[model samples]
Target: MASKVIHAIYTDDDILLQAVKQVRAGRYHIAEIYTPFPVHGLDKAMGLEPTRLAITSFLYGLVGLAVAIVMMNYMMIEDWPQDIGGKPSFSFLSNLPAFVPIIFELTVFFAAHLMVITFYMRSKLWPFKEAENPDVRTTDDHFLMEIDVEDHDVNQLSKFLYDTGALEINLIDNK
Candidate 1:
């Protein structure tokens, strides 16, 4: 299958931002955009939903904490029952001070590692993956917005994009 896309190029982030807003306001569906750097408010302008990574991190931390508690209790109380610091109570909660460091370290370690893994998976990134950037200039000084020409007149859309401050525009077919 083949599809047509319009690549509207911009020299300024502000101009690209305004073009995106205007294009969206006119009920046009933008397929994607590429920029040299992160543009503030771009996600909000694109109406993307908020991510739930914070919640996932919290859960991962809990899992880490639980593992810490279980491992510490089994080792210190149930298995060996050490008498460190002359406090031989032989109880898990009684010796909690000795396990605090492990608990904290494990919690942070699990949350950070799992969050990174989740981000990579969600973004479809992995080792040995080929780059998908369409234009090398987008990584330098240009911003490119890709719009699908599904049912609209290409001439009208290209003119509208030009009016929105696009420095250059090109039509490409993708399969």
Candidate 2:
């Protein structure tokens, strides 16, 4: 089976944003967007829900904190008790102050690394994955908006996008 879509190209982000809003106003469906850089409010304009990556990051940080605390307790207090200066303390609770730096570092490390991995996976950006962008110009200065062609007249949709200031329009067929 083959599916057809319309690709509208815009030279400016502002124009693309406006075109998106107008398309949605007309109750048209936008399949995807490709841009060289992030456009502020584009997601909201596209009617996308807020991301939950921040919540996941906080949970990952908590896991890192727990791992750091347990590792420190086992290594410092139980595994190899060290005696420095005049005091020899072998209790994790009593030596928690000294482990603050390690805990903080581990928490940050886990959160940042795991967040990147989660984003990549969620976006289906696997190693050696083929690119999905229909046009290479979108990676440079152009912005491309993909509009679904379901239950809509192609000529009318292309005409609408042209009126909305699309620099170029293309019909793509996917198998």
Candidate 3:
């Protein structure tokens, strides 16, 4: 079945919560919801699953640290042992301060670049991509909910939306 997109604008958070509660009580299916900023407890009300970005970030950071360690050890110890000013290149255990800059820089480099790549992939937001945002006002001051309902209940859905404190309601047919 095709989807019918609806836009609902709310004045404040309370009205939005009331509308969500009413929809949940009626057992209606909600497709997506957009808000200018996060509404507290909204995820719990919508029954969304926890995000996995944190785990991905941690793993990426660890990989970066491992790469930094191996690269530094190989370059400084085996490949080209530079005896600058008679300073031993065997181990950085004594002159740890000198290695601090490289270690810190590599850690930041890996975490920042890799995490951003992961986030973009996870959100399906690639460079120069256009996403289907139903309403432009949704990014600013409006709260919008896209709901799916039976063909017979299109008018009923509109009426239900208005009664539940929707400032303005509009529908679009998605084939």
- State the C-alpha lDDT per candidate: 0.91, 0.93, 0.80
TM-score of each: 0.94, 0.96, 0.84
lDDT of 1 by residue, 1-175 (tens): 2299999999999998898899999898888899999999887888788999999999999999999999888888898876777986578887888789999999999899999999999999999999888889999999999998998999999999999999999999998
Of the pair 2 and 3, which is ahead by lDDT? 2
Ranking by lDDT: 2, 1, 3
Of the candidates shown, which would achieve the greatest TM-score relative to the real structure? 2
- Candidate 3, 1-175: lDDT as tens digits: 4467676778687788879889877787778888888899888777779888888777877888888878887888778979877878988575466777888788878888998998889889988999668778878888888777655377888898899999988777889
In candidate 1, what residue range of length 10 has the lowest lDDT sum? 81-90
Off by over 4 Å in 2: none
Quote the positional error of residue 155 for candidate 1 in Å. 0.8
- How does model 3 score by TM-score? 0.84
Model 2 TM-score is 0.96
Top candidate when judged by lDDT against the true structure: 2
Summed backbone clashes in each candidate are 0, 0, 0
